[model samples]
Target: MVVYAPAVLFFLAFCVGVLRDRRRFSNAVFLGLAAVFALAAWLVELIREDEQLGRSVVVGLLVLATLGIVVLAGFLVSNGVTMIRKEGRSPANLLSLLGGVALVGLLALLVAAWVLHTHTLLVVAGTAVALAGYVGFLFLCFISYAFLYGRLHIRRRADYVVVLGSGLVGGSSVPPLLASRLERARAVHARLSVRGRQPVLLTSGGQGPDEDLPEAHAMADYLVERGFPAELVEREDRSASTEENLRFSKSIMEKANPDYRCVIVTNNYHVFRAAMTSRQVGVRGHVVGSATASYFWPSAMIREFVAIFLAYRRTNLGICLALLLGGALIWWMR
Candidate 1:
């Protein structure tokens, strides 16, 4: 019961933090810490209840869970590696490298502690520290995502509107996610038109393996069917990714009119990351988010947070490495 006290306190604090400021990253940190503490307490209680079960079932379960985590981490690392191979050195590639190295090191440490005779306290403390490092990494991801989202600055009026490509459902039809983006762009266009300002709509996307036609073509058709002027709509059918979507659309806009201010539309979950990508690609525009289904927001936001963190790999990696090393040293000395 005494051992569980810290977990209870942390949880109470986390709840308070969440209620106070839902938008702050500190809320996530507090909740994550509370969860870890609770899990640790539960594991301890389980071990105490049945020593044999602890040695066999509990240990096995923990090992399996660890392996699953490693596998997922490996997938991310491999994806990063593939991106590097195809696109050359980038911030995302650096994140993969750092994450891969840290994961490998952690696994090696775990194996050493299990196989060799080491001070049990030292091993336990080291594991806790490593867990904390993982939490810090997650927190960094959230902060980066928020930073990008907050920095986006859209003008009151624009001469053109661009709906960025997410992907296609069946090569011709827009998925619910992509449709949300298109609808948001349409709303913005309508608002501008109501104020006597006309803006051209640019739908941007390109053909992929499963896509029967370019995403831009499908988007343009959706607009026209909904009574958008066909003459005012342009299809940028050569962009394969977000970077290409912004860059190619900018080119088309420039050709049509040299001075064009536009807003890029995407899902709310993706607004921040897209804005950062826009800046990196030299696209002069702001980003606006469309509404998303309630159930999809959490996971989608987590994905975007991860993407933004990877965009600033060096700083995040440096912080994580420092914390991990410091924690390991403290545990060893103690």
Candidate 2:
């Protein structure tokens, strides 16, 4: 019972963070830690109650964890194959394949280190394991928080519905991915309208070198073609990236109404990152997610995590370097 205090505190912090502002990434980290400590506390309690029962539980959990890893590796490999077969062999589609192969290779390294009984192999495997553990923890935090955030109901009415654009399919055509976001924005607008609130729907994007038109223009056109009111739709067509999208849209919303509240919309895979960005840019909004294709989600999610990892590269890189140094010291001692 005393051991559970840390878990209780972490959960309280998570609740407070979410209540104060739901967009912070730290909230996710807190929630993840809460779950981890809760599990640890349970394990301790089980061990205290009966040593044999505890041992059985521990062994069963380890077996399940191992099986989960194996299954995950297989799924990634299979999804990679499906991506290649269906979408062609672009670099983006190759992420899951590369990840799966890398996981298998890492497992192999651990086995070789054990079998060979070599200090050098052990050092290498140990370093890899430490780095992977750190990354896997952060990833767990991210995915769990993302899932939780996406499912939260937005009860407050919004003054605006902002749709973040994905690139067009051809030179000017609205792709299914971008269309899904527009459809979501339209639905939000419709819901607000039915509630007697005239919320503005803003499309945010910019022209790329190969694009025939700005993504915002294409998105707005798509909504118009589908019979959403042209008058309520506005365009912010200068943002080149997601940060720029939020920043530029914030400027427009600010001028029209300095205190405007809004809902930003993107795909489910992208919702958490967008929410974080919206907060960064000082937007008074919560984000909502549209649907994404199942085959495309794994690679897309990997890309999102990579972007986030790099965004906090200073801290993450510092941690990895420290782990490497620690591993080096152990090898030197041997």
Candidate 3:
């Protein structure tokens, strides 16, 4: 019972945070930690019951983990190729492909060091591997909790429906990705209408140098063309990035209705981060995501994660450095 206390307490804190507001990265981290400690507690109880069985289970888990990584690498490579053909040959599309190749290379290096029985090489590899593992763990935490966080439902009526913009298709058209978001916004608007709530549809984006017109104007036209009410649509065509999109939209929503509640719309891969950003910008909004193409999702998600990691680069770098140094010290001692 005492062993389970940490898990219970973390879970309790997570519940409190979520109940207070579900749009928190901390809440998801708390939930993930709770799950981790719960598993640790179960493993301890199992070990106490039977030492041999516990050891076997741990060994089996390591094997499974290796196999899982191999499988993931394969998937990433295949998906990356698909992105090249379907999405384009942009540098951004190569992230998954390069990541998969790097993983395979790392494994090969480890095998080479092991087969050669080189203590120095092994130590260096171990330190590098530890750092990679630390970053990978954070990535896992982000994606896993993002999956859980996206299950949030919009029970309360919204006064505004915000559709965040991606770049325009050419200079004057909505891209498939942006279209998906608008379609989802329309559905949300329909639901709010059914609840006797008339939420304003706000399209947020600014003109880019290559674009002929503002993205917000293009999105608003797309919605109207698709039978969304023109009267209910307002355009905030002054934002150049996600942060600007939310901040400027927040300004517009506040000006119109000082006590407004809103829901943001973006592609499925972008939802969690958008919600987090919305919260940061003091927007009272829960985000809902639209469908995204499978081939594009991994790279898009990786890009999002990189942005987040860089946003907290100091903290992330310090943790990775600590892990690397710790591994090196242990290796030196051995």
Candidate 4:
């Protein structure tokens, strides 16, 4: 019971942070740490109550977890194959299969480290494993918090619905990915209308060298074809990236209403990162996610985490240097 106190405190802090600003990634990290500590506390209690029963429970849970990962890896590999067949052999489409193969390789590394009994290889493997575990923990936090955030309800009326754009297909056509964002923006628009408000639907993206027209224009045309009113639709066709999208869109919204609230729409795989971008640019709104292709999600998620890690590279790099120095000292001692 006493051990659970820290978990409770962390959860409370997380709740407070989220309530204050749901866009912050630190809040999610706290929530994840809280969950980890809470689970640990529960295991301790179980062990105290009955040692044998607790040990069995722990073993069963570990077995189930390991089996679950193996099954997931297999399914992802199969999905990756399907993605390649349907979407072509782009490296992105092959992500799931590569990830599955990587998992298998990791297991092999563990076996080899044990069997070879070589200190140098063991040290290298140990460092890799530790780094992987830490990254996995961070990803767990990100995904869990993103899932929670995506399900949040709109508590207030919005002045705008900003749909972030992806690349157009074949220079001029709207792809399914971009369509999903527009569809989500439409849904958000309907919700705002129901609340007796007509929020502007802003499509934000710039033209690429290969694109036939600005992405925002193509997105706007897509919405109109689907029967969305032209008058309520706005376009910010100069944003070449997510940060620029938010920055440019915020300027538009602010010009009309300085205190305007809005929702930023993107695919589910991008919701959290988009939220972080919104916060960085001082945008006022929560974010909502549309569905994404299942096969593309794992790879897209990895990319997002990498982007996030790099965004805070100074602190992360510092930590990595510290860990390396610590490992070197330990090795020297041995």
Candidate 5:
């Protein structure tokens, strides 16, 4: 209980920081500190305990932590190496370089400790610290989403509603998730229609390998079944990914109405990333989220964060490596 004081304090600080200014990167830093303190508290308890059961638990946790670090490090290395050797010194290459440097520095630290006759417990502790740093990074990725989502606002109405496609059921029917998005899009469309502003509905998705038809067609059909007019619906069936979906749909919208104001509709779990993709694809629009199931939110949010992290893989990896090096230096000094 005593070991948890710092963790509790850091957690409070994090909550306060977010409450004060939820959009800033500094909030992420505070949350990261809280995660580090929490991990440290757990590690300290493991170290202080004397019973066999306690020791076993500590060992198991340490092993799991080490494996997680190794796997993450491996992924960084492989991604970096691939970017360097094939893709050149783009952002991905930079990520690989930073990850490689961190791995080397960590390895050097271990060797130095080995040469200096440091206690085995100290080495284990260092590994735990490294793992904590990586976990903190993962925590930051999730925290960024919460921060972004909290700050987002639907500031204006639009002339068109674009519903981005998720997977289709049997490649011909709208799944519940996609249906929710279409429903939201329809509601928005209906609202605008009632105000004497009828917006075109763009259902965007292409055929994947498992699908028998394009996702856009399925979405269009679903919207029609829900009593949306067929003439008001447009299909973008050539897009194979989110980027393509937005880009292709934007092209379609631009051709019909060059000065188009649009809002993208996706599931609540996907709104942030979809907006980011919209920005990336040069779509001039905001995003609106439909409802998602409570049980699905955690995993779906995690997936969205990972997708965003990978989208800017180099910068994110560089930041993580910097944090890793800082943690390693602290471990060495101790």
Candidate 6:
């Protein structure tokens, strides 16, 4: 019973953080910690009550964990193949496949290190494992919190609905991917309108070298063609990236109403990152996601995670270096 105290505290902390601002990444860490400690407490209580049952549970968990890793690695690899086949052989499309190969290679290295019992192999495998563990923990937190965040309902009225653009299809047309976002924005707009609060829909995207016009213009056109009021559809056509999208949109939103509250609409895989970005750019908004194609999600999610990982590279890379140095010290001692 008492073993669960830490879990309870962490859970409370998670609740507090989420209530304050669900966009913060630290809230995800707290939630992950709560789940971990709860599991640990449960295992401890089980061991106290029945040693055999506890041991069996522990062994089962280990087997399940290993099997899960193998399955995930295989799935990522296969999905990568699917992505390449459907979306072309771009570097972005290779992320899931590369991630899977990396995982498999790490596992093989660990196995060989155990078999060879050599200092060099041990050091390499230990360092790789530690780095992977850190990354995997962050990935878990990201995925779990993203799932939680997307499902949360906003009860307040929004002054605007912002749709972040992916890109224009065929240089000037709205693709299904971008259309999904517009549809979602329309839904949000309709809901607000029903409540007698007419929120302006702000479409944010810029002209690419290959694009016929700015993505925001095409998005705004799409909305108008679908019966959205032309006057209500505003375009911010200078953002070439997500950060720029939010930053530029924030400027527009601030000029319209300094204390404005809004809702950002993007794809499901993008919602968390967009929310984080919105917070970063001082946007008074929460992000909601539209459905993305199933085939595109894995690689897209990997890409999103990579962006976030690099966004905090200083802390992440510092920890990786310390882990590597610690492993090298162990190898030298051996």
Model 2, 281-328: lDDT tens digits are 899998999999999999888878888899899999999999999999
* Regions of candidate 5 where Cα sits further than 4 Å from its true position: 1-155, 323-334
Q: What digit string (tens of lDDT, one per residue) describes model 5 on residues 244-324?
A: 989999999899888898988888777767766776678888777888875455445656666766766787777667766
Report the C-alpha lDDT of model 6 over 63-86, residue by residue, as the tens digit: 998899999999999999999999
How many clashing pairs per prediction, in order?
A: 1, 0, 0, 0, 1, 0
Ranking by lDDT: 6, 2, 3, 4, 1, 5
Residues forming the 10-long window of minimal summed lDDT in candidate 3: 148-157
TM-score of 4: 0.92
Clashing pairs for model 1 are 171-212
The TM-score measured for candidate 2 stands at 0.97
lDDT of each: 0.74, 0.91, 0.88, 0.87, 0.73, 0.92
Q: Provide TM-scores for the models.
A: 0.60, 0.97, 0.95, 0.92, 0.61, 0.96
Question: Best by lDDT, which number?
Answer: 6
The candidates, ranked best first by TM-score, are: 2, 6, 3, 4, 5, 1
Give the 10-residue window scoring lowest on summed lDDT in candidate 5.
Answer: 20-29
Badly placed stretches (over 4 Å) of model 4 are 89-91
Candidate 1's TM-score reads 0.60
- Backbone clashes in model 3: 0
- Cα-lDDT of candidate 2: 0.91
List of clashing residue pairs for candidate 3: none
By lDDT, the better pick of 1 and 6 is 6
